[model samples]
Target chain A: MRICIMGGCGHFHTALKPDIELAGVCLTGEETPGFSFLINRFGKVPVFPSYEEMLKECMPDLVVIDGLFGHHADMAVCALERGIHVYCEKPMAINEEQYKRLKNAYKASNAQIAAMLTSRYEPCFYTLYKRVRERTIGNIKLINAQKSYIFGERPQFYAHPEQYGNTFMWVGIHSVDLILWLTNSSIVDSHYFPSGKNSFGFEGLDESAVAILKLQNGVLATVTVDFLRDEDADTHGDDRIRVVGDKGILEVKDERLYLFKDGEEQELELSDAPDIFLDFIENLDDKGKRLADDEAAFLSTEAVVNITGV
Target chain B: MRICIMGGCGHFHTALKPDIELAGVCLTGEETPGFSFLINRFGKVPVFPSYEEMLKECMPDLVVIDGLFGHHADMAVCALERGIHVYCEKPMAINEEQYKRLKNAYKASNAQIAAMLTSRYEPCFYTLYKRVRERTIGNIKLINAQKSYIFGERPQFYAHPEQYGNTFMWVGIHSVDLILWLTNSSIVDSHYFPSGKNSFGFEGLDESAVAILKLQNGVLATVTVDFLRDEDADTHGDDRIRVVGDKGILEVKDERLYLFKDGEEQELELSDAPDIFLDFIENLDDKGKRLADDEAAFLSTEAVVNITGV
Candidate 1:
């Protein structure tokens, strides 16, 4: 499958490009750090400084819009309108207004669009979701998750409101999406309070925020996002979820999933993030069980903004 | 220190009475399966059919109200009116109105009363609180806790609303009190929802309820309460908490405190639950930090009723 990569030299492209063959590039050099690396590997295959130029020249089957987070909706809209499938990273947009626009655009285009909430595609997350659905854990009462990373200096684009929007939109958006997909529930109500001052290049945005999400199924979840962790933290960052149910307790951390039911600890090895991503790629056109699509992406982003006012 | 035990004999009293040399008793033979065990040990101290009679007869220096969950405020008011100090078991009253009455009574009498929110008094819980205070955990943003047990048929008294108001009051109360005390902050706002189906016991009383608690200091906490486990589950009646902070994560489960900071898990042995009765007994002069007293107990109990309702 031929694919064009927007924001070609950025973090996602640097990691995902070698895994998936790329047909074209849209690197402005001003947007990302790894432009030289992309040029070295791909031999300058249709390099363009803008999305419109890339589309007109390459016209690839799929467009991977892994650019600055806040731009996903607009880029995805362009790709979908041109009858190309789109794989976009999360926080489809910063707020509900932008998310609604993306939703409408996706509907109007009637093309395949997926969000890279890859965590939902993981084996452990999917297993836990199935368990909750089957009532294997009984009635869930609470869900608590944390996604913390050590922030040093972010890319210049992250400092722009037009690019990253807010810390909640840029980083917190992952947890918001995963919780809903994992639980198969929608957030009924939510409240967020920003904590820890941010010294980043942005203004009026929190470096750390805590959101209380109340799911429609009566599950209450707390998601904490912090861009301030000590450097040299463990690989893959740190992610944890503690789900309390009437009959059991489930905790996932690192790559191990632990379920405490019948008063015993049962440990299982979880598939890593890459495995989850590969599954999505393989099942792209199955049409029976699609991965997280624009609608899921839109709702999750709307939930995040509703809670954090990004 | 002189003490009077009301509605004596349960696991709570059995564990505590020997620790705090019981000076008097006002048993009603209505408490628990352990009542006969207490009768075997204590050997007929004093018996009263009603709480009012017990208050009038055992006018001791300290009142240890270990009755049913719903009777706390009435018993507290009786002790306070007669200028007696109180250290009562949790869900200090059925509702906020009753808690207000007890608070006013204690204020008028100038008595030192403390709620037996013994989890706060537990050495592990206290250590966790102190660690957070000492910045060992840094700025806390997320707190998740659970307490569940294999539910059994309650005594006939439970069918009477006059005895046990709700399951959230009877058992879930502990989690509410602990979240407030451990965070050292008042709950600013909260949203609680029923778990779709009652797993613990009956209607009108939540067998299990989920609460998204917002602390005054911007910490987000989610707590769950349930009494629906298998009859033979080997769990320790359920206790766990995961506190995520800027620096690291601290988790406590089954008397083992695990600190995961700086990228490794450190196991620490925790001491047992505090001898609450001993603390209240030793502080009979209205001086020491009493449990379920006038001020603090009211807030804790109010939280319980707010989640469960009277």
Candidate 2:
């Protein structure tokens, strides 16, 4: 089956392409860029100048859209309208209007679609979601999470509002999706405050934004998404979630889960994301079951839009 | 030294009076009437019918003000004007004007004074503070902290708008103070959102509020303070702070400090809380070196008042 991958010129493709067979990778950039070196190292794969050209030539069975967060909805809609399954990335769009259009397209097409909230596929979150469902922590009441980084210039999204929108919508939405998915809750009220702006000799966008989400069950969560720190410290990237329930507290940070059970603490080993895309390929083959579903990803992105007032 | 302790007929006195040489204690039996066991246990400490009567009679050395968060500032000022020192509970007042008055009175008087942000005195926070300063976590870049509980009965102060002009000032300020002190950074910018009325049905009181603070030198922090979760959970009662720095991320929740270092995670033994009054007592003897100087505490309170827009 021929596969056409959009947004192939980006770093995501640099990681995702090796996991699956790509009949053709499309980019707005002409001249196949650095893929020749990749082809020399791996194997030969065809490259197309644009997504439209690739779609026409390959007639691909699946179209994976790995474009910027703000462009995913439109590209996914285009793919769905053509009756092609789509694997889009998180923060599917800038606002609810885009999400609404995407939802309409999905309904109209009955297309197999998925979103890449790769963090959900992480072992730590997967286990927490399971335990919370099994009532291991007993009636989850609150979820507090953080996804912060000293984003350097390497991720060009921070420098392009047209691509990342804001730190909250770009990287922060991962925690937003993971928390809601883990607790099986939906946001009822939400707000965001942009902290450090672009004046610090930093690149494009607000340096960071703080968001508060009140879930339907009255569980309150505050998530801070930032791009203002220095990335010299590897263990210092703040990616964590803490759920407070009637019985105890369940926290997953970095690569471990701490269960505050009966006044004692216990640690459990969790995945450290050695091969993040491996799960995506497995799920794509399974029609993306047990991974972050399209609806869940959409709601999380919707929360980001609401908070950022985008 | 003589003393006048308010809320004298209640459980607080039961916890505090053992360490206090209370010459007088004031009680207002307005709700369910307070217990008289204090008079039975420590007969030497007179039980006054009211604050006025106690003030007219005892003229004590210190006013141990344990009133609600809203009223403590006003009562502390009144005590200070009469040349009495004040040792009050968290959130000395509910607005900047009142906080200014409290600060002014402390300055005008020749008496020793302090506000009880007792969580700062908690062993876990002390350990975390020392360790961070000692470079256990290296130079900090981000902090996420919280203190919340299941909303109890509408606080007496909530009913009196003259006192608690804002809910964020009443409850959220402590979490604000904690994050500021833990990171040891000054504010650059902040934004907050209130979560409607208290879920426990406190009139005019916000159920919760969340804020994002940008610290000088580019570190960012977020804090959530609420009274909207079950208090039984281990993560539900005390304050929690996570500081991500250049070397490591240190998390202090209640009485435990969880440290992430060199690809391994472990809990550290924290310190013990002494009589918070001892700090003021030492400062009184030296006229310097207080745990939290009035100016510093006032600055934190001002940051909170400004963020909540009270």
Candidate 3:
């Protein structure tokens, strides 16, 4: 099967680096960092001049869509209409209208799709998921997650809400996706609080934001995201989640899982993580059982769009 | 100064274990833990028959009120009306009506008052506050706190909402007061979520709860509280707070302050912390310069009542 990458604007394309073979590559006509990453890793693969031209001529069996945030939905729709599988970056669409169009196309297509919600595929989180599935922490009642990112260099597209979407979709979507995936619950109630007070000179960015969501499965969850970490911090992102169950507690911090149970705190060993790109490709054979499958992508994006309304 | 303690139910009476003269003591017609604590620590102080008698006959200059959750407000009011300074366990009031009554009595009296918000007086938190006040972390942008406690032994009053109040007022108020004290910001918007599904056989208790508040200073803050911590865990309470500013981050986890700044994570030395009860006593002469003064207690309790409505 031929695999093509559209818009080297996010790490989604890197999923192709480990195992899959790339048919073609498309850049957003700028030297975005993601393109540099592709160049550094794959070293000058085939390039497509424009996204539309590639969709018309180089339509491969699958298209990994990244690039500017607003353009992702239309690109996915274009690929899906041709019965092509689409694996896109976070926030499948910037608004409900775009999401609706993509949804209609996805329904009619004889293809599989997914978002690059790779957190579920990380070794630490994967292990945590496995333990929770094993009832190590029984009956998740409350969950709190935090994602802190350094305000590193950004592409020019981020200055426009139309191009980059809002910060909730860009940064906060990760936690929302993780929580929804773990709980497997529908949002019954929610409150969205965003402040663009310290926007770090970006017009559409909220440097600090938080949301509280009550799910149908008797879970109260919270997400706090910020882009105010010092740029020179150790890692680009600091992620944490604490799940409190009636029986035990599980926490993940800095890519490590800490379990508090049996009256002792233990750092559990990580499970082997599968390649994200391979996971998506394998989902074609095992449709509903895929990790972070189509439903998760759509639901998480829809939730973010509803929360941010951008 | 003559100091008396009323209603031995919480740890507030323990403050008298050090450097203070206990003029008298009163218990709420039961062998509550506070009375046992006074007996074990001070070998029994001057015992009064009832709270009213303590106010009228003993008439100590200051009173430390800690008893049934709902009874704290009226006890404080009684003491404040007699011009007796008060250092009470949180929250000062459970409902707005009770808070209003306490406020009136406090306004009419010349006595000083404070809550046993000993967290701000602990070495770890006191150092963080001092450094934040010194602008070590720059402008505060967002904050999140977690308080997890065991569903251990409870007094008889906890079985009723009218006597115990809700979990937010009982447990979540600690973090609310801490956030408000640190940011010095009034809440402009807020949302509270509470669930009593697994209340550990208590009627009014919300085993899991969360609240999000947007402060007037453009800071977004959140509080998550749970009575689901495993009963056999290391400590009865596991508390944490993360303060994020534009320039840096300050976090306190399990009584240790972790600072993330200058591209490094450092644990700073803790400063000497003063006794909370003695702080209020000294504030009688120092006036508004107390650590957590009258406004802090009333504002924190008022916020809790508004959020929980119990």
TM-score of 3: 0.95
User: Which run of 10 residues does model 2 chain B get worst, by summed lDDT?
Assistant: B8-17
Q: What is the DockQ of each candidate?
A: 0.29, 0.26, 0.76
Model 1 agreement with the true structure over A1-310: per-residue lDDT tens digits = 6778887423455235455656777764455555556556856576677897788777777888777766777888888888887777776677677777877888888567766776676666766666667786786767777776766645666556676677666677778887787677898877666653444555555667666677887776667666655465676466677677767877777746788777677885554443434444566667336556556767777887787764
Between prediction 2 and prediction 3, the one with superior lDDT is: 3
Q: Relative to the unseen true structure, what is the C-alpha lDDT of residue B78 in candidate 3, on a scale of 0 to 100?
A: 88
Go through the candidates in order and give each one's C-alpha lDDT: 0.68, 0.68, 0.84
Q: Cα deviation of B69 in candidate 1 (Å)?
A: 2.4
Order of all candidates by lDDT, from best down to worst?
A: 3, 2, 1
Choose the strongest candidate by DockQ: 3
For residue A6, what is the lDDT in candidate 3? Answer: 80
Report the candidate with higher TM-score, 1 versus 2: 1
Instruction: Please provide, for model 1 over B42-118, each residue's C-alpha lDDT reduced to its tens digit, 9 standing for 90 to 100.
Output: 56566666667766776677778877666777888898898887777776778778877877887799667777676
lDDT of 2 by residue, B268-289 (tens): 9877755566676557666457
Task: Score every model by TM-score.
Answer: 0.85, 0.79, 0.95
